[model samples]
Target chain A: MESVLDIKQLTMDFGGLRALDHIDLDVKAGEIAALIGPNGAGKTTFFNCVTGIYKPTEGDMFICPPGKKRERINGLKPNQVTEKGMARTFQNIRLFQNMTVLENVMMGRHCRMRAGIPGAILRNRATREEEQRVVEESYAILKKIGLAEFVNEFAKNLPYGAQRRLEIARAMATEPFLLLLDEPAAGMNNQETKELDELILRIRSEEKISILLIEHDMKLVMSLSDRIFVMDYGRKIAQGTPEEIKNNPAVIKAYLGEDIDA
Target chain B: MNTIKELKKSFLIALWFMFLTFPIMVIKVNTVEQTIDWRWNRLAMVGIFSFFASWIWRYLLQRKEMGQKRAEESETPTLTFQQRVLQNPKFTRPALVVICIFAAIFPFYFSMYQVNIMTTALIYVILGLGLNIVVGLAGLLDLGYVAFYAVGAYSYALLNVHFGMGFWACLPIGAGLAMLFGIVLGFPVLRLRGDYLAIVTLGFGEIIRLILENWNEFSFGPSGIANIPRPGFFGIKMSIHQSLIYIYFIMVAMVIFTIFVVRRLQDSRIGRAWIALREDEVACQATGIDKTKTKLSAFALGATWAGMGGVVFAAKTTFINPASFTIWESIMILCIVVLGGMGSIVGVIFGAGILILLPEYLRAFSEYRMLMFAAALVLMMVFRPHGIISAVRRTYQFEGSPEKKASS
Candidate 1:
């Protein structure tokens, strides 16, 4: 499989704290990769470092856009990283609460808009046409996420699972080649988790986008992830299919051993 | 039946002529002392005439062709609640452009007094845009923004009087001073948010005012600096005797330039960072937007504009004083932002025009002018609490990269 992301010798430190130690991982294109870790195992830190939330203390990061040679990406700002075909959602939902769900999605389209400040302010025809298209595209994305009815509703008002879906939809609106999801199933119960697994599958296949998901839920991760990477003490302990990871001794010592159904 | 009512309205037209004309006919304004009966009677006559005229027009006139050609096409049709607040083309951009052009060109077609009022309105527009940067875009409540205005005025006054500098030279120097003061002020209250920021800014404004009042040796005490130079193009002073078309041009030019800078700043990456900060400060920082730098830059930019405005005002009026840059001035500018719509460039101008210029017409209303203004504000707020222009939905179509761009 073609690699969408390649991280080598990635090290992220918060002063005295090593949030993510020297580690490496790769997510293949058009596949779901679950990053499983115990609490304080730096799953989110790794995610952030990749998405440019925290620039790696030292590392080489590369993104392969399908047929091209893997392009090196390091130390860019989060939005810049997003502009380079990457999008991310926070552990807790970070939708623009006051903005409507559709508007929230439309904000992601900002990277795509060609009309500059003057064009929009002057209300040029191209800007107007662009705005209309954004609205329509946002509406379509909301419908895909099954939140079309709530398109006009403020993001903060959505249900927890719905907000999670909306966050995904918003990130998708950016048309990212890689989606980094931090705890998509956090606070979700069994039913939502089930629906999410189905949604994730549909998105990976239909959008043709690779996903890097941080998940605490063992069953969902084991079942849904095409490749599972286990982390412990800020280091990648093992990476393989769910069956291989299920039996790895280092992975056992790390996150899954305690949580996995025997 | 409605036609008779319409006839009554047309008959009421004579009354409107009486109303609009009678005050000028009965007692010439600017007399300094007018009979009480004349002022009271003129106001009553105008009110009664408008009351009947509107009554007939509502029943008789078609929905589209309303009174006043300007109002006829621009008035928002009555809409359902959601549509009223959340409809496309709520603000017709072209209509606004046309209206702004008319406003910009109006001095050429108006009396000197009207031009004077418009110049004042333009000053307020600048102030409102400045405040919008601090309070609207950056989401930082600044009660002391007017303090920078005072600083700019004082800077210009002190520089021009002592150094014999021209208005053009003093302008940048005044703005630099205001920017310095803004940085000083921003440093103290940088960590604060919401009402705390508001109160701190308010205190700073008052402190500036007090310093100006007490600094007698340099500031000329309560009397103020007078005989300040008015701006001139080459050598032509924008004196009242001059065509006034020239001053109008300057005022229009200032308005245009100020709005352009503000609009540019609002769309840049920094603008998005400011909005992100406004939306959620923690998230903004997490996304690598430096909160301190962003906040301070917003303050500096806002103050720079206010300072520039103060210099022009000092030059335009040919005077400077602590009295002119009062706490009331700060509050009034803040009101214009709220009345117009926070985070909207055009909203601030709309609010400034109504707040500053409308009172000129209500001059005969005397004691009632302020009361009527207050009522009008209340009415506008009741109807559109979000101000006249709200969210500017800026979207990127991505048509260049994709084949699915939607039409506006």
Candidate 2:
């Protein structure tokens, strides 16, 4: 499978600390990739760099959407990155709290829509049709995410699990080839996590969109990821199939502790 | 026991108020006669009034807290009475019709002075709605909104003075110029947010005023440009009363036009982007919204309304001065947006009417006008921080929607 996202020698610095150093990650087309790490291991920093929230100190990043040419995306703004078929959800579930769920999803379609101020004020036929299509499309996404019932409810009023799914639905509304989720299952219960596991699989199989997630849930990561990359400090400590990662000594050491007898 | 405790609390509050007002209410010194006159009766009156007022204040506070608790505890929160009334088309449609009818015949029934006051209220209504776009929807704190108003007014005054432009022509010119200024102001303060953005916009407003004040040759100095012509009526000469009514109708038409455009814009894609931008900047960007573009558009669009309002103002007053475009005007406009409910159309209209008309009608008690305004604002903030009518999000309804459509 061809890799949809290619990151080479990604490095990020905050004053004296190297948050992400010499890290390389690849997310193949239609595959679920997991980036797992210990508590200060720079997993989110990697996502931010790829999403263009923070300019990497030094690196080259390229994205190849399905059937589209691979393009270098260095120094693009966050919105520009999203416009280039890459979308992200925050670690803290940053849904527009005041907006309704459907509106929140429609917000994802903003860059794709072409209604300017004049069009908005005039309510021309084209603008009206585009708006109708957006509503229908956003509603479809909400239904798929099991948030159809709360479509009109404010994003903040939804339950915690629903908010997480709504974020995914919102990101999907951008119609991205690569979706980056920063801890989508952080606060979910076991049942919610199980549902999320299924949802992620469905997205990859049905939508043909690749995913890169930063998660602390070992079971969800171990089960859902096609390939797992383990990071300790700022380096890519290990990368392989889940089976290989489960047995890797370095991965075990980074996650658990070293055996005293050994 | 609880009653006694409550009474004791009220008594303490009254006592505290008495102490605070002792010099103002209880002591009166006659400078001419050099004699001190102690007003024990006034002190007693203040004490009794405060003693009862404190009781009502506490009771309302308790009720508010309980209401909040109930809202939180409920699975689906009950709609407020105001929200219910607003949400029901059955109520709102007729209410709107009644208001329209009243607005149409108001000038015909009332004196020209009253019509003039109503026109002023209508101008504030437009101004409030315009400011609502920035401070309300976009969540940009623009303490210098009057700067854009000044730009609009000056654009008209200067163009009319130099090029002999008419009010009808200067309207769009003023609005366009204000929008240009909005974009200019928007560029430098693009990175600022919250308090910093407010301070910068405030400075921008003051800068406009100072330039107009000090530039004697350019703006006619502090003496101002007077005798600016009112809007023409197809070359027909009219009496002052006739023209005042004419101006009132012109303002009415403009206000309706503004409301129509603003209402349409509120639920559009650009408006959604603005609300999202207001909610969370990073998330908004992550969702594929260009923050710079959204912010600048907000500033420019907001200033467009202020510009038109200003032009209308110049035409209505037939005068222009820097002092008239001071920070107080910006603050008053901001107050209208806030007190009426940010991002809410009807709230802004009601706020402008109450703020502008109340002062006009209460000219007999002019001495207590500011006092009443300040007291009303304080009471409003304490009781309803979201303004008289909090903004309700627009709900999209479609034929193929799964469940019952949500109504705002």
Candidate 3:
């Protein structure tokens, strides 16, 4: 299987403190990979590094958009990383709070669209048609995420689970070859988690995009992720299928007796 | 109970007013002999009037609040007949048409003095709209926007004096120079946020002013460039009144052009990117928005308008001076944007009108003008902080009833 993302010897340091240390991770094309770790395990730090939020102290990161050439994207800005066909959702739900749900998704399509000041001011035929297409495509994404009813509502006004879903909807609008979700199931109830599980599955099958998620929900992790990489203290502890991770001794030790099976 | 509470509030308010007005209002100036006179009677009258005024205002506000609470409790969400009529396109569209017609004919009825005032107010309206693009839409607190206005004026003045360029030719050049300055200023401070950004911009504004003041040969060293050409009508010189009317119409055209452009930008992709950048810059970047490009576009676009305003101002006043582009001008423009409600086109116009016209009408009380303006601003911030016309976030939905299609 061709890998969509490749990270080697990734290390990040905030002055004296090392957040991500010598991590090697990969997510193959169309595979849902899980990066599970205990608190302070540098999962989010790794995501930030790969997404160009932080420049890794030492590492090589490469992204190969399905049919595109593998490109080294070490020090590219976040938008540049996104332009290279990777999109991500934040752990804290960073939707454009003041904008409507549809507008948030439209923002995701910003890089895909091209309309400068003159075009925007003139409202030429091409600009008008492009804008119309953006509206329709954004609405379709909202409908897929079941947020079509609340499309006009502000993103900040949505329920907790809906906000998470809207974040995914926004990310998906970018048409990323690989989607990175930071705790997409965080704070979701059982029913919402079940819905999220199905949504993630549908996203993989229908969109045909790979997903790399940092989730603490074991049941979700076990059922959804095709492959799981366990991390502790900024290093990978184990990598295998869900069943192998469930019985791994090193994973159990790192989780401090919180049974992976339970 | 409510009456007593209102009385107490009114008393405190009256006391505060008395403290503010006693020295300034009670002292009368004798213009002829330069003698100071104290008018105790005037102080008492003002005190008594303020006391009653405060009490009445408090009572009315409380009643309005109670009425609003009752309405909210009912939760019917239906508009009244008046509101429905106001919202109707038939009424509003025609109303807008009428207003535009009135504005077009307004200068013909007014005297030169009134036309001049109207022109000044319109200039501020343009300035307010320009600043709105940066501060309101992009959430960049710029305290140095007057710098761009000065740049435009100086550009026109220099080009006309040195190269003998016409008004029409200088307009674009002036605006382009100002936009260049905006980008130059925006580059280094791209990393700064909030108060820090404001401070840097404020410094940049001062730096421009100081350069103009010190650069004797280029800027004429505070004497300013006088007799700058006024725009002519079809290669013919006109009388003062005719010129005033021409300038008035030109200003009107400029304002309309500005409004049309801004309205279009607000609904477009660039506008959405600005709003997104304002909301969460990190999220914008993650969503594939180039922050540097977005911020630079905002700065440059905003400066473009201010530059045009400066060109018009130079032509109208026929003089260019660093003093005219002072910090106070920037603050006034910022005040107009804030008082109008940030990110609202109509709000900015209304805000500019009130601020400009109120001071003109209060010319009799010129000494107390700024003090009263400051007090009113504080009161406005307390009562309606969002502004006189708080912007309603507009959403664009797909055409032809997507809701119906989805449900079916």
Candidate 4:
């Protein structure tokens, strides 16, 4: 399978502290790859670096859109990275709190839309039609995420689990080829985690997009990810199938400990 | 016990009023002798009246609190008559139409002085709406907004004097210049947030005023550009009365145009991006919104309206000066936006009307007008910080209930 995301020697430093230490990683097309680590393992920092929230100290970050050429996207703006078909959710929920769910989702479609000030102010036929399509497309995505009923509700008003799902729904609206989720199941209950598990699988199969997630939930990481990369202290310790990762002595010592069931 | 509590509240209120009024009431200006005249009787009357007014105010407030408690105990929400009227389109739509009709005929019924005051109030409404886009919708606290108004006024004044441009031609040119200034000012302060943004903008406003004051050759210095041309009625020079009415109509048309444009922008994609940026800049960027572009657009669009207002103001007053575009003017415009609920069009209009007309109507106490204005603003901040009208956020609903649709 062709790799959708290629990261090589990605190094990020904050003065004396090396937040990310020359980590190399990849996610193949339509693959669900999990990056699991202990606290302060720089998993979220890695996501931030790749998504252009932080300018890396040094590295090559390449995104290959399906059936398209591989383009280096290092040092790009966050919005530019998103325009290049990479969307990410924060470890903490970061929805536009005051905006309605539908509005938030529609914002995800912003880069794809081409209406400028003139088009908006004129409300010409083309602008009106384009706006209508944005609404329809955003609503359809909301329905797919089972948030259709709360379309008019403010993002902050939603339940914790629903807000998390709304984030995914919003990211999907970008029509990204690779979706990056940072601890998406952080505060979810078992039922919500189950629903999220199915949702992630469905997203991979139905949307045909690769997913790269940083999660602490070992069960979720083991069950959902096609491949697993274990990290500790900003350094990758092991990379293998979930089965191999579950038994790897270094992975157990660094993160999982002795009990695989736990 | 209740009567005693109410008495205590009234006493405290009366004491506060006495503290506020003592200097103003006790010292009277003797215009004839050019000396201060002690007015013991007037001071005594003021004290007595304040005591009674405080008693009445406390009584009313206590009754309102009691009513609220009773409503809470009932556990059934009931809309007040005012709220019901505001919500029902059948009443509100016709009421608005009637109001508009009356507004249209007001200049004919009122004297020229009253008409001029009304025109001034309308100008403030335009300023309030323009500032609303920056502070309310975009969540950018711009304390230098009056600079744009000054830019527009000076642009038209200079263009008319040098090139003999008509009002129609100068309007767009002035607006464009103001927009350019907005972008220029906005670019440097794009990274600043909150208080820093406000301070920088305030500095920008002062910078513009200082430049206009000292730049003698270009801006005509402190004396200002005088004998500016007035807007014409199709090549006909009318009498003062005819001119007042013409300007009133021009102001009305401009206000309507502003409302229409602002309403359209509020529902557009760009508007959503602005709101998102306001809510969370980081989230906005993460969602693929270019922060610089959005901020610049907000500043430029807001400045555009202020520019139009300045052109009209220059035409109406037939003079332009650095003093007219002071920090006080910016604060007054900001006050209107706050006093009307932020992000509310109708609120800003109502706020402008009250702030502008209240001073005019209180000419008997003209010396105390600014004091009263400051007091009222303080009271507003303490008692009703959201202003007279809080903004009603727009929502989207799936096609279902008519009531939901109407409310949304």
Candidate 5:
């Protein structure tokens, strides 16, 4: 399988504190990969580094869309990273609170849209047609995400689970080849977590988009992710299939405690 | 019991107010005659007004709380009166026609002084709308907006004196120059946000004014440039009355054009990018909005209107001076945008009308003009922080689903 996102020895340092240390990770095309660790394990920092919020101190980061040439995307701006077909959701929901749900999704179509000030002012036939298409496309994405009922409602007004799903839907609207979700299941109940599990699987299968999610919901991660990467104290401790990670001693020690026999 | 308690609270508030206003309101100093006059009746008036004002304040607060609670409880919040009027074609179509008719006949029906005052208000309406793009929709606090106004005014004034340029030609030139200045200012301050941005912009405004004040060679110093020609009507000369009316209609047409462009921009992709940028800078960038481009466009576009307004102002007064483009002018324009709902066009027009025309009309009570203005602003802040009409997000009506089409 072709790797959609490949990171080689990525290192991020904040002064003396190393947030992400020489982590090698990759998400294969159309695969759901999980990055799991305890609290403050630099999972979010890793996501930030990859999504161009933070520049990695040392590493090569490359992205290859399905059937496309691999392109190095290091030191790009966050918008540039997104434009390069990688999109991410925050651990904390960052929906434009004042904007409507449909508007929020429409915002994701911004990079792809070509209408400028003149187009906006004139509302020429092409601009109008493009705008209509965006609205319909955004609505379709919302419908698929089950947020159609709250389409016109302000994003802040949506229920918590819906806001989380709205974040994913917003990311999906970017038409990313690689979707990075940071704690999508956080603050969600079991029902929401189950739905999120199904949503991730559906995204991978139907959309053919590779997903790299940082999640604390172990059951959802274990069930959904084809491969799992474990991090501890800014280092990648282990990487394997869900069953292997469940029994890995290094991951176990990092997560639970050191084995007494050892 | 509650009503009595409320009365007691109001009574205490009124007493405090009276005490605070004692020296200023009740005691008048006759400096020319060197006598202190004790106005007992004035004190009583203050007490009476304060008492009722306090009661009304608390009542409004209670109503606001109730409205908020009700809004949270309901699925769809009830539309405000302004929103209803704006949304329903039944009200809007007739109201618009009536307004147009009124605007057309206003100069003929009113005195030249009244027409002049209305023109000033219309200029403010344009400035308020222009600033609305940056401060309201883009969520950028631009304190030096009047600098762009000055740029426009001076561009026309300088070009006309040096090269005999006409108002029609200078209109775009001034606007373009102001946009250039906006882009120039936008570059250095691109990294700043909120208070810092405001402080820098404030300084930028003062700098522009000071430059005009001190640049004796370029701007003819503080004495300023005079006798700039008004917009011509096909080389046909007319009386002052006829010209004033022509200028008024020109402003009216400009206001319409501004409304058309601004309203269209508000619903476009770039507009959404701006609002999104205002909402969350990080998320906006992450969603693929070019922050630099959006912010610069906001500055550039916002300045464009201010520039146009400045040209009109120069032509109207037939004068251009540094004092005209003071920090206070910028603050006044900011006040107009804020007082009107920040992002709403109708709100801006009403805001400019009330802010500009109210003081002019209140010349009879000139002593209390600023007092009333400040008091109204304070009251507005307390009651409606979002302005007279908070900007309503455009709702895209969803047609039948694609699935439905396939089935049909």
Candidate 6:
């Protein structure tokens, strides 16, 4: 499969400390790639760079998206990255908490809207029709995400699991080709994790989208992802299939923070 | 499709067509008798037509397919024009066409006093739209926006009075001065969020007002500069030479032009960016929207309009003092934005019209008119915090546009 994303020598510096350094990775078309690391291993920074949140201090990242589309999205705006069919979920939920769930979703679609102000202000026929259609489509996505019931509720009112899912739904609302999920199964119970694992799969296969997930959950990274990259201090130290990664000595040492008990 | 529905729909459609075209037929005969007759006819027509039209529309909208219409009826959408337009494209354009036509000819059709009233209202319309860019679109609370207005007016007044320059020349200079003040204020106050921002702005307004009050050197202290020069087009004063009636048309033109430009901004990418910032500041920064640029743009854009309006206001009255740019004026302008539904151009116009003119019109209730306005405003906010209008969400036909993801 063709690589959808290619990062070479990606680095980030915050004054003196290096957040990310000389990282290299690739995500193939329609691939579910996992980035597993300890808490401060720069997984978030990696995701940020990919989504254009943080401009890498030094890097050449080439993203050859599926269907012959290719670009360097390293320094693009977040919305611009979204415009290029890449969307991400925040490590901490960043929903428009005051707005209605539906309104929040509509906001996700903000970049795609073409209707001019007059059309919006007057709610002209075409605009009305489009609103109905968008609402319905949103409803469908919500139902699929099991958030249909909370459509009218404010985002802040949602439960923890639901809020996490809501962030994913919001990111998905952008209709991205590449999705970056940050600890989607974080703080969830075992039952929720199982359900999230299923959701991760559905997003990858059903949506015909690729995923670069930052997850601390070993089981999730082991079972859900086709390939996994192990990061230590922002560098890609190990890369292989899930089974190979589990056996990789370097990956275990990085996670265990010292020599593992033989 | 149903019998009563079809008959009722046609009747309502006929009435709508009549109401839509009424202003065109009735206004600008340039004769006394015709104007009176047309005025009464149009008023009577609107009253009778709207009553029946509402009845019929209510009847037709009860159909199963119009679920949203049903919702709108149950709880009046209270859409500030922006919301309605955003939510329903079908309702927006035709309705907008009607509003544009009315706004175009309102001065022509109304009395001279009414024209004068509308001119003040148009000035507010410009102010409201400018503030909408700041408070509504960008979600920045600007309490001292009128300070910028004062700067614009004073800039024009001082420059013209001292240098013998024309109102036309001072327009840009006034806006530039206002923009400068906006950036100066924005830089310091941008650090403060929400109420703190508002308080800082409130102080800013008062500070400017006090400076004007005390500044004997330049601002002429309390006496204020008179013969400030009324704005003229084609070298004719709106008051005596041009007829406030024609001035009404000009004010209407100004309001429409303002609404036009504002509406365009609302649709543009920059507009979306403002809204994004409004929706979530963190997301905005994370999205790579330069916070400094966005904040300053709102300040500059808003001040630019208010400043230009100062030029118009100065020319319209041909006199201005520090008293005109008081804290109360700032509050009133804020009320216009809040009451009209922040961010909505038409809503602000309605707000400015009601708050400024209606009180004047209610001479008998002069003492209590403000009370009534306050009561009405309070009720509207409580019942319809979205304002008289909300940000219209335009639905597109294309499936490419993402659905409004109901926030979690």
Ranking by DockQ: 2, 5, 3, 4, 6, 1
TM-score of each: 0.63, 0.95, 0.90, 0.88, 0.95, 0.63
Compare the candidates by lDDT and give the number of the best one.
5
True contacts kept of 5: 0.82
Candidate 1 chain B worst ten-residue window by lDDT? B399-408
Poorest lDDT segment (10 consecutive residues) of candidate 2 chain A: A145-154
Q: Rate the local accuracy (lDDT) of all candidates.
A: 0.78, 0.92, 0.90, 0.89, 0.93, 0.77
Model 4: how far residue A26 lies from native, Å: 0.9
TM-score of 6: 0.63
Can you tell me the DockQ of model 5?
0.64
Tens-digit per-residue lDDT, A1-262, candidate 3: 9999999999999999988889999999999999999999999999999999999999899988898999899999999999888999999989988888889999999999999899999999999999989889999998888888777777876779999999999899999999999999999999999999999999999999999999999999999999999989988999999999998989989998666676
DockQ of 4: 0.46
Q: How do the residues A9-108 of candidate 2 rate in per-residue lDDT, one tens digit apiece?
A: 9999999899998998899998999999899999998988888889999989999888989999999999999999998988898999999999999999
Order of all candidates by lDDT, from best down to worst?
5, 2, 3, 4, 1, 6
Interface RMSD of each: 7.1, 1.8, 2.3, 2.9, 3.1, 6.4
- How do the residues B298-395 of candidate 4 rate in per-residue lDDT, one tens digit apiece? 99999988898999999999988999999999999999999877887888998999899988998899999889888888877755566777655565
Clashing pairs in 1: A113-B396, A129-B408
Angstrom error of the Cα, residue A235, model 3: value is 1.9
> For candidate 4 chain B, which ten residues in a row score worst on lDDT?
B74-83
Q: Kindly report the docking quality category of candidate 1.
A: incorrect
Instruction: Encode model 2's per-residue lDDT on B199-223: one tens digit a residue.
Output: 9999999999999999999999898
Supply DockQ values for each candidate.
0.07, 0.71, 0.58, 0.46, 0.64, 0.10
Top-DockQ structure, candidate number: 2
Per-residue lDDT of model 4, residues A117-222, tens digit only: 8888889999999999999899889888988777777787788999999999989999999999999999999999999999999999999989999999989999
Superposed by TM-score, candidate 3 places the C-alpha of residue B79 at a distance from the truth, in angstroms, of 9.1
The digit string of per-residue lDDT tens for model 6 on B1-408 reads 476876666666657766777767565575756554456576557657765766665564454236555554542223344454645778878888998788777766677677777788888888888899999888999889899998888888888888988877888899888988889988997667899999999999999989998988979988888888765566754445355555556567667777877886775545666776887876665433556767887888889888988877877777888899988888899888899887777678778887888887889889896789778887776557778775554332323223433221
**Candidate 4 positional error at B189, Å:** 1.4
Candidate 3 chain B worst ten-residue window by lDDT: B74-83
